[model samples]
Target: MPYAKLTITVPDAVWIGELSRAYPETRFRVLAATADVATGVARIEITGEEPEAISEDIRDYDTVTDLTVFESDERMRRVQVETTVPLLMTSLQNSGVPLEMPFEVCDGEMAFEATIPQQNLSKFGETLDGMGISYRVDRIQQDVESDPLLTDRQEWLLDEAIERGYYDTPRRTTLVDLADELDIAKSTCSEILHRAEERVLKDYMGDEKGARPTVAVSSD
Candidate 1:
């Protein structure tokens, strides 16, 4: 089936644009986001550089009508922000796209990947247009489901490493640090990360015969 990965630049009304404007230096990753239609509120888990700083910054936005901090660590946080604005997540759902998890928010943009039907691509576009939302199609291609990418254990290691900031530009954490956290050998951690990265690249690129077109779609 054909799939598309979208990197959408949301409006200032949403949390991504709002928090990015407030705290440009810190990175923000949305671990989970759900729009409760009945309540007319979006409950989101925003993970970012300083929990306390973000908490203080959030108070400035009237759009975020409610806030709750579920957990925090030195590197990142998992807090719930209830907002009144119509969210990009909601927009995607309204479009009927099957979104992938662990989307991110940074520099006023939200990145999401979804497996959408080839015929429904236009439907998705029309849905976004109807919602009056602007977005960009980062990648759209035919997915190779037959080929398995990473093993469950490798995926776990990669997810953990990412959460620990091992992939940060300056390298917030090291392989040694990750190993210590997981109580495993440094060599083991390195092996898993390397292998996982390889699989991710392979999957992203796809096989030569199965490679599909990649177009940059933007409302601008």
Candidate 2:
């Protein structure tokens, strides 16, 4: 398998791209999306100071036939909409690459991480190019099947840590914060994350010397 991370600049003609450019500060997290031959549906979490206004704007797009707000607050709004299929998504479908869901779009760019068949990598790139979708491959690595690499709890905790930026440079969140969020003891959280990280690193690096550098999971 091949694992890749891609950043794509959405064309302004697309509704989501136009909206992202209009409100550069807003973050659109597409939690779920599906498309068929005639229509597409997307469930998005819009986060910003004026999510209400943004939701209103989404309803006004000609391609959006229906928009339903499921939740709203001062900083975020969750909405589902029926609209035309996005070209980027169509390209992915054509390329036979499965997208990892819950991707983010901000400042007119969308980020995607996917694990695909080794033979499909070039086809994926070609499909994107053919659709006129501008994209940059952030990274591509040979990967093994990851499903059996970690326990379910370990995998869930790792996802939480990454989503909260616990692994980011300079560290946006601390181990203590993560533990608090998960309602677990700090030591337990650290232990689980450490074990998960070790398993992932070992699987990825194998016998490559110096490839498995220590990761400090604690920022207390």
Q: Which stretches of candidate 2 lie over 4 Å from their true place?
A: 145-220
- lDDT computed for candidate 1: 0.73
Residue 87 displacement (Å), model 1? 3.2
Evaluate residue 58 in candidate 1 and report its C-alpha lDDT on the 0 to 100 scale.
Answer: 79
lDDT of each: 0.73, 0.89
Clash count (model 2, backbone only): 0
Cα lDDT tens digits, model 2, 29-72, are 99998876568888999999799999999999888899999999
Worst 10 residues of 1 by lDDT: 37-46
- TM-score, every prediction: 0.59, 0.67
User: Can you tell me which runs of candidate 1 are displaced by over 4 Å?
Assistant: 38-49, 147-220
